[model samples]
Target: MTLDEFEDTPGDEAAPIDMLEDYFGARGWSCDRGGDDEIVAHVQGSWGKYELRGVWREEDRVLQFLAMPDIRVPDDKRATLYEAIGLVNEQLWLGHFELWANSGILLFRHAALLSGNDGPTLELDQAETLVEAAIDECERFYPVFQFVLWGGKSPREAIDAALIETQGEA
Candidate 1:
């Protein structure tokens, strides 16, 4: 979606929520109200399924997007996953990629802090950029997780194999 399509306020709602509502809806993904001002977005990627949650913090005035692959990262691979994620997170600009030790869930999390001058206004590109980064990170590193989980490859080996130069028609 373009910047013009994201007006500051879409009706009575803030732009962050509206931008996500329209963005995910346009892709035909089920955008359900996930209670507590959060919209849960579910979509299937090339490697596996994913869940993107957009939570609008009314008090903090921030929109946080949490993206996680459907696959439950095994505990045995957590250390290796952390190693691989360290390399991956270093290259990221927007948010940090993390695996929650408590839940064994790998997540791409980002937050856009909005200004409360007139109202919480979120630019379309700003919201889109966050979501895009989340998805991009998930898609790019999915294979590494699979390698560690199913292929039984070491973290270094998996990252090395996944990061190899892949040339093909886009």
Candidate 2:
């Protein structure tokens, strides 16, 4: 659904996921329901595909989105990956990168505190920006991750190389 339709929804009568699914679908974005309280999508960016997972937390009155690349850090590179993620997160605005130790997964996560009397945030525009920014930042840092994981570049080198600004309208 459009943002207007979402805003018109009765806060207490329907779950956010219903509106979320429509919000994404109406934009020609793929949305997949992951169980009762989650929606998953692959957001394509210049760097690669980011798996964007939106999860609803009933107890906290919050909605969270995690955007992650398709690749995983190898067991041997986990330590370096952690350092790289720390460097990458230092410059981020909306979310931070994390390495899931048990699963060797890397993700950029952002959370939205629910508004109104019930359900998730009514600020769909902010939600869009959060998700888009997460994916964009993921793209910006992916090269550093690759350098650490397979190119044998030191954390500083990888981060510095990635940080080199290209002149253009951002």
Candidate 3:
């Protein structure tokens, strides 16, 4: 699915990471530019802390962003966590959750391709939305992962519990 928002510009396009940095800075988020094409930002969510990374590939004109929460699945919980990821991803409209194979790190990833007549341009609003989506999805599903890893709950149970809608605060 096309998860990116774009606007047509007449001239040369700045790298996507640069645009992402500006968005993060505007939100007062702590971010570090890894290089010309990469940036990492730290954001706090209600469930946990997050590390958001943006990488721009000039060759392919693609911008990839990842949001990783401050939680890790133990080796024994890997199987269960994978099941929970599938359930969580099914409900998402924009991005999906994944557990890194090597690190067992859970994260949300989405990519936008800046290909067309417009070149590699990304609007500020699009950048902001992209970052917001990542954090928002991560926050929404944090408890599901925790349910499987720590609470010994089944994947379906975790998803059901996490997705329950409450009418008002207690």
Candidate 4:
């Protein structure tokens, strides 16, 4: 679900963040406070070390969800950074949808970043299809972040649109 679609209930302004924390904890995940209003959860799954960070800003009424591996890439291996980034991006997308569907919840404003220390790089951004038109924009530059604004009727549609955009770039 997108930030705007995450309804604010009565008498509970921070309910969203609390719900996320609870969800992760109930699954045997360890949660820690990252920044002032950010919660980071760590879970060791069969795939690898999963680190999910949720940043909530009450003042701005914004929330950001970030997922990546717990390990940091060494400076020397930066040459093959694309491989690492691809792994992270693929996992995040597959994991996010799986979790959301399992929990019967929607995720909006979904974006991803795939960076590489070497030359080749790719970025993917997508959102729910009903919420907005599909956007599959890419650049040859590194350090690119893909933005997917959620709140669509169907996540599949959004993903399809994004894929089309990605294909066009390629």
Top TM-score prediction, candidate number: 3
Q: Candidate 3's residue-wise lDDT over 1-170, tens digit each?
A: 11222233332245588778766765778799988889999888998889999998889888999999998878888988988899888898998999998998999999888865656777766787788899889988899888888988999999899899999778
Clashing pairs in 1: none
lDDT per residue as tens, model 1, 7-52: 4436524467776887776566778876657788888888888999
1-170: candidate 4 lDDT, tens digit per residue: 33333332232222445655544554556788765566877655333445566666655545556554333433433334333234334534322221132332222224322233552122111212211110111111111212122222133343444345333543
lDDT of 2: 0.77
- The global C-alpha lDDT for each of the candidates, from Candidate 1 onward, is 0.80, 0.77, 0.83, 0.37
Model 1 off-target regions past 4 Å? 1-13, 167-170
Candidate 4 positional error at 106, Å: 25
Instruction: Give the CA lDDT, 0 to 100, for residue 1 in model 2.
Output: 64
TM-score of each: 0.84, 0.84, 0.88, 0.39
| lDDT at residue 15 of model 1 (Cα atoms) | 66
List runs of model 2 lying over 4 Å from the truth: 1-15, 168-170
Model 1: residue 152 alpha-carbon error in angstroms: 2.2
After superposition, candidate 3 runs with Cα above 4 Å error: 1-14, 116-118, 168-170
The stretch of ten residues in a row with the least summed lDDT in candidate 3 is 1-10
| Cα-lDDT of candidate 1 | 0.80
**Can you rank all candidates by lDDT, best first?**
3, 1, 2, 4
Report the C-alpha displacement of residue 128, candidate 1, in angstroms: 1.5
